[model samples]
Target: MADHRAALRAVVTQRMLTDPAHDLAHLDRVWLIAQTIADQRTNQRVLLAACYLHDLINLPKDDPNRHLASQQSATESEPILAELGFAASEICNTQHAIAAHSYSANIPPESPEACILRDADRLDALGAIGIARTFAVSGALGRALYDIADPFAEDRVLDDQKFAIDHWKTKLLNLPAEMVTDGGRDLAHKRVTQMLGFLEIFSEEIGHPLPINWKSV
Candidate 1:
């Protein structure tokens, strides 16, 4: 199993795209986070495999097939798992975890491994690193950092597709509320606060006066 992990790492190194957000560094980060929250009851092997292989395939954020990326990644991972000599049950469990980890997939995790993977990966989208990943994707997409006219989207309908900062109001701000475990939730709240602090300062810097603590729209 140890050798299999090494081999799987090699496979991903050879195949993963140069995606700035979902790169090998992202996988390693998620893997490390999973170890923190996972307990003795869960299958570390499946969770570990899912960690390494969840983003085995990457897609552009705006790609029409973005929602299908997780499913496709699961489909593509089967052969790789088999080649690594994963047993049938373990492969299927790993596949389930991978297929369901995407935010877009909306597939309820059926196992502890899936929950840990999803929770940990989503955590990567919340903190300072999350901000870096968001801006990286935005820059790569040639997106403006924010809408000058309505930087906080107070009156306008939030459209992240048009601006990067809109993503905080539309998605990132909502992550702390969705975390699945006590540890995940506690860390997420801290991260969310830190992110809001950044936004508050950024708003002041941009002279937008966008209210970071708006109770409502």
Candidate 2:
């Protein structure tokens, strides 16, 4: 196989790519998460490749075209993967994992590696680190911390574009339910609890007694 890792690192560094929340460090974390969740049925190399290369075409959270980023990545990855000397099956497996890992893509993971990579990526989007990332992206976009009138989004249309807090209700809070693996689900539940605790603290800071009803709305 060709030296994809070396080639990718060179590309990332040479481009001076820097998204505070989705940079190489984030890839490292997701790779670790995948490694931690890897099973006998999973192809380790394919899964790891997907983890590192999935965000090769990352879109900003507020981008109107963000949902298309995954498939776009999959389409864009072929030449790079081919040049890396990936076998046909490996390239297919890696592309599927990358394509389906996006929450917005809503593509059903079709293989063990696909499911594992999906769970792994979502796991990275929960808990303390997830909080930091949410705010970092939000801040970069000039999004308000919360809606001053309805911080917890109890009585208004949730708009993560305008307020980062709405993301908790809109996406992050439901991630544990979406986890693809038993272990990933368990960890998601734990991380979501920490997120809930943080929400409680946020409510106190805002002096709002809003309660979370993620199941209904």
Candidate 3:
């Protein structure tokens, strides 16, 4: 499996034009996380290809075409997969995994490999890494860290597009429930706990205590 990844890694590192949050390092992390959650029945080749190419067409969070990025990536990966000598069926599975991995894509993962890839990709959007990625993306887009008057959206709408921290409430905190595998859910819960802990200190640092409702998992 490691040898299989080496060639794909080179290709991804060479060709992917990406944002800080969706760089080669992000692909590597997704591969590692996918391994942890992958069961015996999982196909390593399909998972590896999907993880590396999932963000081949990385789009900004605010892109009107953001929801289509995954599908585009899936389409784009076909030639690469064929070039890499992947069987037709393997390529099909890999494409499905890539296409179904995005939250915005809203495609249900029907295959085990797709489910694992989706969970793995979503896992990267939580915990400490998730926090860093959120801020990186927000900073790139010139979004504020949080609403100064309502950091937790206590009285206002949750708008992650404007405030980086609101992403935690808008999507990140709820990812565990969206996980496909039991192991993925378990790990997501643990990561959410870590994020909540970070928020506790973050809230205090900003001179506002975390709301009691959000204090625990």
- Model number with the top TM-score: 3
Q: Identify the runs in model 2 with alpha carbons over 4 angstroms from their true place.
A: 1-7, 212-217
Give the alpha-carbon lDDT of every model. Answer: 0.86, 0.82, 0.92
Stretches of candidate 1 above 4 Å error? 212-217
Which whole-number lDDT from 0 to 100 does residue 141 have in model 2?
93
lDDT for each residue of candidate 1 in 29-81, tens digit (9 for 90 to 100)? 99889989888878988888899999877888888888889988998999988
- Report the Cα lDDT for candidate 3: 0.92
Per-prediction TM-score:
0.94, 0.90, 0.97
Clash count (model 1, backbone only): 0
TM-score of 2: 0.90
Please identify which of the two predictions, 2 or 3, would achieve the higher lDDT against the true structure.
3
Candidate 3 local lDDT, 1-217, one digit each (tens) = 6766888888888888877999999999999999999999998889999999999898888999999999999999999999988999999999999999999999999899999999999999988899899899999999999999988999998998899998888788889999999889999999999999899899989998899867654
Clashes per candidate, residues 3 or more apart or on different chains? 0, 0, 0
Predicted candidate 2 versus true structure: per-residue lDDT over 130-215, tens digit per residue: 99999998899999999888887777889988999898888898888888888788888988988888877778889987574743
Candidate 2 lDDT at 179 equals 86
List the candidates ranked by TM-score, beginning with the highest.
3, 1, 2
> Each model's RMSD to truth, in Å?
1.8, 2.5, 1.0
